[model samples]
Target: DAGVTQSPTHLIKTRGQQVTLRCSPKSGHDTVSWYQQALGQGPQFIFQYYEEEERQRGNFPDRFSGHQFPNYSSELNVNALLLGDSALYLCASSDLGTGGWAYGYTFGSGTRLTVV
Candidate 1:
């Protein structure tokens, strides 16, 4: 039973560039959510995906998008990145029916994106 996994643990991109972060959900998990955490700030929800559809979204702009695969894996895509986008992008997985209360969510180590 592997936990959520994210790729490119660290990344650096110029302003206006685009980046894609990937995640694989933990076994038995069916929902995937993305979050952004800036320095000294708590994680901000980006969006969540389930059944290969966008189930819910946060206050992020349209530039922040995501997709969920049939296998329950997911990807977060950021376009026209800004310096403010520099942060730790975390992926969390949970079962839809669990309401994320009993077992809680499993989070990835996150991808550190630095926009210069």
Candidate 2:
């Protein structure tokens, strides 16, 4: 089955601009979560979606928002991006009520965003 995928593999943007990243969940999964991982740092969850609704969220500014479609794909949007916003954006997919895969969530490589 196809695993999670994200694009563009990399991004470059200026401060105060807006950016949107996309993600497609693994086959048969119904939940998607967005995370931000700074260089050499662990991922910080931005939000999670299940059944096309925002089921959970993390500690992030309102500038960080996301959406999950009925097809289980998702998009993350950041407004007024700052240099600090530059980070590797990761998209994780899970089975929702099914407790995910045996090894837990399936994560995409990531979208490397560089805000200058």
Provide TM-scores for the models: 0.95, 0.95
Stretches off by above 4 angstroms in model 1 are 100-102
Which predicted model would earn the best lDDT? 1
In candidate 2 the C-alpha lDDT for residue 35 amounts to 93
**Model 2 bad stretches (over 4 Å):** 101-103
**Which 10 consecutive positions of candidate 2 have the poorest summed lDDT?**
94-103
Residue pairs with clashing backbones, model 2: none
Model 2 per-residue lDDT tens digits across residues 69-89: 878899999999999998999
Instruction: Give per-residue lDDT, candidate 2, residue 92.
Output: 94
Clash count list over all predictions: 0, 0
